[model samples]
Target: MSTAPTLIFTEALVLLGGAVVAAPIFRKLGLGTVLGYLAAGAVIGPLAHIITGAEEILPVAELGVVFLLFVIGLELKPSTLWRMRADIFGLGSAQVLLGGGLLTIAAVMFQLLDWKAAVVAGFGLSLSSTAFALQILNDRNDMNSAYGQRTFSVLLFQDLAIVPLLAMISILGNQAGSQSASLWMDIGIAIAATLAMILTGRYVLTPLFQIIARTGAREVMIAAALFVVLGSAMLMQAVGLSMAMGAFLAGVMLAESSYRHELEADIEPFRGILQALFFIAVGLSVQFNVIFDNLLLLALAVPLIMLVKGLSIYGLCRLAGSSHNDALRIAAVLPQGGEFGFVLFTTAVSAGLFSNATASLLISIVTLTMALTPVVASLANHLLKGEAREEIEEDFEGAGSDVLMIGFSRFGQIAAQILLASGRDVTIIDDSADRIRQASMFGFRIYFGDGTRLDMLRAAGIEKAKIVAVCTQKRDVTDKIVDLIAAEFPHCRLFVRSYDRVHSLSLRARNVEYELRETLESGLKFGRSAITALGVSEDTAAAIEDDIRRRDEERLQLQAVDGLRAGTHMLYNRPVQPEPLVKPKRGAEQPEDAL
Candidate 1:
């Protein structure tokens, strides 16, 4: 007898197959994973009808958002958040308030639904996709750019505003008979629930993770991670608040924990897959029949909404001190609808704020807007590609020296400064606008751009330079710059900064001649201080440090040839022969030259 395939099995196949097929293709086409997942869901559920109902998948997939907020929370502690007060409160608050207000007015003028419904639509559309925008910014290496910071600050504010908006929705939409609990009671429960999660994270969860980690089982650790997420989510849901918000709070509390990095590493893959599923569910929710019936309407409405949102955000960015080009970049990248659009829309509808038809239309428009983000950002980038500054090009034209520094971060700055003080003409090219700006304040002619770019190197006169020093400790980036210079400008001497012994060996494997572990020298100096603090003579401590340094350098040089044998020798702490230092008595005077 023939048996029907299990529904779960079929659904899983459809979801996985869709993602597997679409992700690489869209990524290859430079559209990014957001569009890929969206397209997959559209084809599977809406068009092909392979997976007809996304209802069962959506609630679990919604946890994707919870995980995302959790990760975001981990990255932002109270102190870090305080330090960004200007960006968060000033720029961020302005974007949401202004964007929401203008949209509300425009909707009211057009007589879209009514004042109440317009309020929902206004604040709803004001949120840009955090995941999408961050991905695009990181891909372009612009997350540290002024525009990038501004856009992120605004996004952060929007994420926070979700809690207040929820409370507002419940207040406005709760009819007399429909109320489940008093507003004050619900508020109290929410507060108590948040506190409980924080306490549990600090006292209960940390110990629990510590115990679980000792088991030495990968599955147990993964299980523990999932337990924390789902447990916190359930606790929050029990208290009449957003589950995702509770997860975010839990993450914030755990931000200071020693296990944070471990937890993050475990949760990241799950977040990505679950988030993809969430996007897929969004795609499945699209009603193609309705879309096709009003294709022309959507075609116009989508662009209109995107234009309104983009210009509104751009204007706010400009008002907040972004340059014309920077404002354009922010506008182009953030005009799209956010994932929160779906969340708030569902909440709005359940509260009887708008009809299903209106919701569907808005959802369609938002999806289309998100799909067009990459195109919009590319065009905006093109618009910002003005000719290289005359002053910059002219300065680079003649500024060839014996020294070329590839980074201008804290590490690179010290190296560049020492060379500059010693009368060397050093051209430092850095990718960070912040670093470059700070360097300019100190009268350094630091150029801002990626060192890996061949044109940038040529402009910096890499061919004519003598020493190419890559002082950035990011091994991947350091290795890339090292490869570029070694291949094209082999005559130049290369000095690289490594994070540790392994990183140094990796650089050595790449045939890098000069590699200094970033912390090794400072650590040695600190070691000398510790020796002296224990009552050893300063001269003896200094001599011991010198011997240690000399032997380590000798080992590093030996390891540069074949790393395998030499690396093992260094790793095992093989003994080195050296003369014992003679300590001076307390009454004795130091040598005159040493003094």
Candidate 2:
């Protein structure tokens, strides 16, 4: 059979079969679907050799990476990128340069190759798999944590850096005069094409999307999104750039558009399928025979690469202003070689710039490193846990101030400032090293510790504190802290930030006082005031705001009472009763009907 037909059939069968069989098993084991896909590729490609034509399968797999980049671009707004410039530029740049340079030096010491080859190898191995790392972090619900955000910023920068690195590699290859003036002309054309696409995407795509959106046709919207990605990718390829970069640029153009969410929703399914295939294809391409042959080399290289990358990351984090412990954790979490390394290694090998033996050795090392990242990250967490506990204890011992702040985030920072300016002896505790460093720079008395830990709270002078503000973002963390404070420091008044009605009730259940839903109350008041200012009837605006406030308070009370008894009281544990559309007569309404 022809390669094209074989590829199409294998892809469809593998995707469908893999999802049905592998997904549940992976979930049960608490591993991600990406691992499942990798396993699937191993079974189909190496074990059974069912997917016989890998060369044909690869281009299709490449699409998955392209689409993934597109989605990443969509997520990265200019403002968000700007906010993370420190992480992206400082830590990220350092990781690449230092990690790569160290690896190059190691390669030379090993007598593997000349300086140029060693440099290429170093650059290839410095990147940690953004796909794998991010997926694991997201699965563990750590994406919102300080370490997770820092890791993500570094990964984002690496993805952006790939473009320039690839360009340089191409330029160096052309310097050998393998191709004529056509090579340089091709490079210039590619640069112009990429630039033109970005300009057109920025100026024309949004309005074009707006016009398509007027049709209110979901299919057309999806088609348009696909067109932008595929069209740009084709343009990029025609001019000698990677199609992935084009798709990424197209995604960035749509980042701030009004239809961003719509485009995302439309293309998400395609992106997911393609991305899974991409990972599986990576597994398929892993030459297991070669890996087995070089088992000793693989074993040695894996740990060495990880150690080098980890040390580089540690130094970078410290330079970026993280504390010693935090720097260690960040370094430990990002020691693996990334997906891009696989791509780069394969490209260099195909171009005859890397020896078969060297390429095989590098691939084996990269794969092993990638596989071990989760275990390494978990070990890092374990090591840091002891230090974290000790720090919490010390912070609690030092506590006994007039005011205790549970979280030193943006909201807590402001609260801490006002309290301190008013001459109160304030002690702040936060889990984020980045935030703690900022606080230290500004001369705030802050301790690095989890507020949810009862011992930490006690050590933070919670018992003696006049007020304890639970100003953290996570509702679960806030609730735990409130419960602990209520149990151990009953005299201290607790003020907490509630994200919504649900969150307010969670706090209220623990008998937290001064619960403030950051948005609901403030938003209602703002809307009402705006209407009143716009010549709306004062009575109407007042009535609306009052109704919202009343409903909010009532819901909080009902949820609080229900939450207290749900675990032990059968009556409270009954399935939730729906509220009436219209308010019932006062006397006719049950106590539960108030909310």
User: lDDT by residue for model 1 over 304-334, one digit each (tens)?
Assistant: 7778878877787788777789889999988
Whole-model lDDT for model 1 versus the true structure?
A: 0.77
lDDT of 2 by residue, 22-62 (tens): 75787678556666777777778888886755556668777
Task: After superposing candidate 2 on the true structure, give the runs of residues whose Cα lies further than 4 Å from its correct spot.
Answer: 1-11, 79-94, 114-116, 140-175, 178-187, 322-334, 385-595
lDDT of 1 at 481: 84
- In model 1, residue pairs whose N, Cα or C atoms come closer than 3 Å (at least 3 residues apart or on different chains), thus clashing, are none
By lDDT, the best candidate is: 1
Indicate the residue-level lDDT of 300 in model 2. Answer: 83
**Backbone clash pairs in model 2 (N, Cα, C under 3 Å; residues 3+ apart or in different chains), count:** 6
lDDT to native, each model? 0.77, 0.75
> Residue 105 error for model 1, in Å?
2.5
